[model samples]
Target: MVNIIAVDDSALNGSSTGRIHFLLADFEFTGADALHNSRMTFFFSEEQSNSCNKRGVNPMEPACPRVMISGRVKKLDTTSPEYEDNMEAFNNRHKHFKIWVQAHHFYLNELEIENIFIVAYQGGPRTIDAEDYYNAQL
Candidate 1:
C-alpha cells in the first residue's frame, strides 16, 4: 500500500466547509525554504500510515501516486512578533516536518526499490493557479 501523510493549513478548500482535499496540496517549497514555518509543519505517525494503507494504493508502482500534505500556522504571517518570541517552538516544528519527509525517503530507500516515484515539484504545475498546491510537504 502507498504510505502517505497529508497536512493542510486552510482546513479545507477555498469553498468547502470544515476540511476538504483541496487545501492539502496548495503550495510547494524546496531547498531550505521548507523549514521556514514551525507551525506550518506535518509529520507521519502510525495513524497516518494506517490511514494511507487503508486507501489501498500501491507504493511500488512505476508512477506511484502522489500524496500532498499541508498544514496551517496559528497565524498567517510568519514574521509576526509572536512568532519571533516562539522561535524555539517554531524550529522544533520545522524539524519535525523535515523528519517526516526524510523518514519517507529512508523507508523507500531501505526497500532498495525503484518505481515508487515522488514528484518533488510544487504549485500544481498540472493545474490552474487557483487549484495549485505545494508538493514538498509529502
Candidate 2:
C-alpha cells in the first residue's frame, strides 16, 4: 500500500505541465529483503485536443496519451509475449495511480490532465542518486 505524504504543484503557474511529488510507504515485501519508503514524482500535461486535427484523425479528438515511467523497472523476458502484456499492465497501473492522487489531492483534481509520467527514487530525495538506489522502472 502507498500513502501520500506531501504534494507540490507550484510549477503549474508557469507551464501547461506540472509535477506532484509524494512519499510512499507501507510496502508489502515478498522476498527476503525489505524496503523503507519511496519518493515518487508524477509529471503530467494537459490534453491537447488540437494536435489530432493536424494528423487528420476523425473528429479531431485527442488520442489517448501514454504514461512514461522511468527508474527502477523490473527486467522482463523479452523473448516472451508476456513482456508486452506486462508493460501494458504497468502503464495502466500508472494511470490509476495518477487518478488516485488527483482524486485525493484538490489541487491536482482541478487540472486538465492528459499525460502522466512518473519517476521513482528508492530512498530519500537527498540520497536518491546514491549507488544503493540505482534508477530503474518497475
Candidate 3:
C-alpha cells in the first residue's frame, strides 16, 4: 500500500508569525533517515492580517516562492577519499529527512521553510482611514 502524507500548519502552531510556511506534500516515510537524494519543492504562503499587514485588513497579493535544490547527506570523515572541495561534492556531505525554512527563525514540525532570496519591500506607508476626503471636506 502506498501511503501519502501532507505537511500542513496543523502540525505547526497558529501563534507563530513573521515566517513563511512550507508544506512537504506526498511521499511516505518509514523513518526520518529514510530519505536520501530525494528532491522536493516547497511553496511559501503569505498571510494578510491586522498584525501582519497592519493596513486595515485589506488582503495583500501573494508572492511566488522560490525553489532550492537540496538533498540528504551522510556524515563523512574529512580524511575520507570521497571528500572533495568541489561545490557539487561539498554539498553532498549531509544526510537526513528535514525541511528547511528561512534562516534566523526556528521551524516547527509542521512548518518547513527554505531560504532563496532577500527582498526589501520599499514603499511609503499606507493607512485605512480616509485622508483626501477629510481634508477636502474641511
Candidate 4:
C-alpha cells in the first residue's frame, strides 16, 4: 500500500522549466522495506494540447492532460537504462489512464487527491482545505 505523507503544490508556477510545470508529492510505502519514504514529481503543463481530439473538437481545451513522472525513489535507479525504460512504460500507461482535475482534486486511476493546488497562468490558484488522501492500495 501507498500512503501520501505530504504534497507540495506551491511551486506550480515556480517549478516550471520553459512551458512545463510540476508538482511534487511525498509518499511512504508500507509492507516493503525498499520503498519507504519515496518522492515522485509529476510533470504537467497548462499549455499542453490534447492529441486525441476529434475533428470538430478544439485541441486547445485541455482534455485529459498528459502527466509525466520522474523521481528519486529507492526501488529504482535513476541513472540506469532500465529506469528510463520503466518510466517510459509507466508514462505510457497513463496515456490511457490520464490525470484529471475536478474541483481542485487530482485523480489518477482510483486515487483521488484533494490537497493538490491547481493554478493556471490566467488566474490565481484554487485551493482546498488540506486533507490527507492516504492509505491507497496499489
For lDDT, the strongest prediction is 4
Off by over 4 Å in 4: 1-34, 39-41, 50-114, 129-138
lDDT score, candidate 4: 0.33
Residues 1-138, model 4: lDDT tens digits: 343322222222333112111122223122132236344434454334443353343433444233433333333345766444433343343443225322333212111233445443334544433242233222
Q: Model 1 — TM-score against the truth? A: 0.22
**Ten consecutive residues with minimal summed lDDT in candidate 1?**
106-115
User: What is residue 57's positional error in candidate 4, in angstroms?
Assistant: 20
Ranking of all predicted structures according to TM-score, beginning with the best and ending with the worst: 4, 1, 3, 2
Rank the models by lDDT, top first.
Answer: 4, 2, 1, 3
Instruction: Assess the local accuracy of residue 32 in candidate 1 as a C-alpha lDDT between 0 and 100.
Output: 20
Which residue pairs collide in model 3, if any? Answer: 73-94, 73-95, 74-94, 100-113, 101-113, 101-114
Tens digits of per-residue lDDT, candidate 2, 1-138, equal 322233332332232123232222223231111133222323222223444355564331224232332232122344666444433343343545555434543111111223334322222222232232223342
Show the colliding residue pairs in model 4: none
lDDT of 3 at 38: 32
> Cα lDDT for residue 33, model 1?
32
Which whole-number lDDT from 0 to 100 does residue 47 have in model 2?
29
Please give, for residues 15-125, the per-residue lDDT of candidate 3 as tens digits.
Answer: 323222222322324223234533333322233123435533323332321223122222223364422322112123221213222232222221122233322233422
lDDT of 2 at 131: 30
Candidate 2's error at 17, in angstroms? 8.4
- For model 4, where is the 10-residue window of minimal lDDT? 16-25
